[model samples]
Target chain A: MNRLFVFCEGPDDIRFFEGVLKSELREGYASVELIAYAGMKHIRVDGFIRGIGAMGDDYLMVADIDSDRTVKAKKNRLKRWYRELDTDKVIIVIKEIEGWYLAGLNDHASRSLGLRPLPGTDRITKERFNRMIPDHYVSRIDLMIEIIKRYSIKVAREKNRSFRFFYWKCLE
Target chain B: MRIKQVSCRNFKSFSDLTVDLDEYNILIGTNAAGKTNFIRIFRFFRDIARHGLGNAISLQGGAEYIRNIRISSDVPTEIGIIFENELGVFSGVRDTRGGSHTLSFHQIEYRFSLQIEEGGYRILEDFLRISCSCTPDLGEGESGQGELRITHTEDGVFYELSTPEGIAIEITEIIPPYLQKNVPRSGTLLIENPLLVPMPGFQRFFAEIAIYDFDPRTPRKAIPLSGRSDLEEDGSNLAIVLKGILADPEKKRRLSNLMTELLPFVQDIDVRKFMDSSIYFTVTERYGDEHPLPSSVISDGTVNVINLICALYFDEKPFIVIEEPEKNVHPYLIARVVSMFGDAARNKQILITTHNPGVVRHADIEDILLISRDSAGYSIITKPARREEVRTFLKNEVGIEELYIQNLLGL
Candidate 1:
């Protein structure tokens, strides 16, 4: 199995990709060893990317839209960002990671929290979504992991175009 | 007596993190990244010196918390520290432990591997040895820093003594009797023994080391206490220490003068007789113009600063491990404290763990040990100056603190 370094935003992103995503991706592909490169260090991203590239491990990444909605717009605006960071594959979560979590929220999980099922295509507002979470300190990724397990990948893909493309890329 | 390097195995968050020590060290990391645990490694030794091994292990949640959960080893947890003896050369290498010497300084290395059993943790191998330096204590016996070696066995149960003229092994005769008499507060038996007095190289080095942590609440309690030169973990002796310093006209004046620099108050520090014969103080305002501040009523920051200043001045503990000097003080005040520690480190080796950016920014890059948790949830430590990229950045910049404020310290 190849040693794949999956670069994500934070510990939460790492937990989602490594703990949940990899657990579901174990059908045929080699397990990925996730490395969370918090883009907070914006100036040193290129240096860190270059350092990881020199490590010989294939780099896969996921970045949040943070502000921009389109990937091309983000790339155009963040021209100074290390665009060549991804060696194998890369994807962006629209608006923020909450949209991906909302896309994967099933009825049972939504009802468990006294909430109705969210439309697969709907963009999640951080304020509205965080209202359902009673404990703020608990890992939002772990909570999403439980909800995503029962989520229809087909429905999530249909609602979230970016997540859908990323999901297909994972199988590929 | 400077700690050149330390390598720890199976310590919390660190499977193996070895880094060289600097005069002024700032151990910085995100919350729960085990910066405190890394500092505990030094505290563990201090506890052993103050209390025993059993008490030290129990204080930090026992051996289970100490052993790195990643390793399932049948062997014991290991920690090795190396320093240069007075006559040993600074090899700055792990392997050269009193083996080969080119300088007058004798290299000394102490390794302790503790194994936890049903009852308590057992110290496996802990011994101190110096590079061949013959002290003239052997009756005007031709002492010219010659090939006189004081080596201890791997079990720490024996000493392998060798001189340029002779060689002697003390497994049964001298070693057993001395160790039997020792109370075992530390891993090694080198505190203050007549046998060790013959060669003061290793003995003096270990004795000068001291660790302290002052609790702010201690100064608030009205307790009567006597002062000593060495300050306790909590500033329980705040009033007593003040009283002791106040007794000495020169030292008392110096304390008030230094306080003026750190804290601006036109008042004096007074210690009065409290209620009982315990650690408490009574703050009263009886004077007309000059309101003398008692230790109990002093602000938390003022008390902490006073304890720190007293520790630096009176306590001659060459190797001092202070937890967080940045506590209870303004950031600007903390910056002054950091510089004071920097000066203190010049005379005595000081290791500090802090969340203060003032310390990180003001301290030299070589002194910063940036600690971070890896993907496996283990802590890794690195000196920013040791890295070429960070060194390149520092070459162009005036402010290193901005590296941290900009969230670039993880490098």
Candidate 2:
């Protein structure tokens, strides 16, 4: 049986992927492992890809489209570091992972978190997401934990175009 | 009683800083970030309690060296600590059954500052205050709430005791003749006459704050059988301490189980007295034909692990400060060592400094105190858990070791 290894840029991305998408990934692989590099730039992507390849396992690299206008531009930026990177296996989060977290909340879940239901979340930055957190939540981490618990994949796919593309192309 | 807070001014790398201490604290930072200097504060207090203030200052290379180099010599070096006893209120009176009741204080705040003089140092300021609430039923006159305050000024030292009714009385009239004759000018009255402080175990608590920076070679060497049961700062008397622990069947079994769990090769450990009136421990391996290996032939890591176990388990000190507990410890066994320290912390306060990622990975965010240097080279201490970014990273399961390695903790 083949193993699927999902690499994330940081713990927030890892938590979102593991909490909401691990089962979807398990459909095509016997086992799924989530690894966080803490930050994408800190990792030597080529070495990690080769190391995982040598283990006879498939990998998915997840990143945020920070400051990049398009997925093609983001891929181009990453290509400067490792030209041989399998851009086909790369999945870019629209704007940031905070956007994906916001995308998962439906009207009821949003109101429960003391937030208003958002039509779309492609432009949600970390600062904007933090501003949306209710006063009762002690910290951003606390709000993030609650968001993961109530995350709805179907709502996320409808609210985020990049998430919809990721679901269809990779998870589906 | 346990130390709840410590403040230092112009002391080593600390110009003016205060840090709150928990039951278990882990100090993490780059080399020369003042972790050692922070631990030195405890040692300074211990020295002052055991020896006089003058000797304690000299032990750290005199007042000039003890003070922050950036600050001028005219600025007095200051150190203060607050202790709290959470157990219960203590009664100082003796019961009718001929048994003496334990004397304890609810809170103690002591602060002192000294200036570097021409030939030697002189005490510029000395202060100590203790507050306690006694049960009315304990004794006839011991029922009311009272506070004792000792202050030193330009004129002379004054001892004042106040009652719950706000009535203050000069306690100097009742001072013992011996203490009056030996009024300290170069030292604190609290250290000079701890018996006069009205609290038992206060002096011992400060004097017995054990700070260990273990050297494996010292533990490997055989020490005289007459060595004290307490583990030395360098762990030179490991055998003597282990001998005391092994005498108790319960502690010995726990130690044996821990050794086997940490060092799988070991079957048992035993101490032996040599013909030269010295003693050392030997480790029994499960498979080796040379069943019991002497301490001399044991590995440095093994000796250090044993010494640490003895220190954490056997030492009766109220506070234990160890520098770099991961030193010579294998990565695999580092978790066990840290877990042992955590378990031991429940009974007494434990503080450790570490540069090892394994140690940080196993520690809770709240237990960690990050030390960094400011632009002026003064040490700054902050709890990473209190920082918003750190909490976000940690709540998302990012290993703190990663944050430390990447310098993402914001120093």
Q: Pick the lDDT winner.
A: 2
Poorest stretch of ten by lDDT in candidate 1 chain B: B92-101
Q: List candidate 2 segments past 4 Å from native.
A: A1-172, B86-104, B138-146, B153-156, B165-182, B185-189
For residues A111-167, could you state the per-residue lDDT of candidate 2 as single tens digits?
Answer: 988888999998888778867777654335446656877999999999998899999
lDDT of 1 by residue, B241-328 (tens): 6667788875765665455546644356666775556544333333525556555566788778878877766566767777777788
lDDT of 2 by residue, B261-299 (tens): 457678888999999799999988888776799899989
**Span of 10 residues, lowest total lDDT, candidate 2 chain A:** A36-45
Clashes of each: 13, 0
Listed in order, the DockQ scores are: 0.01, 0.02
lDDT of each: 0.62, 0.78
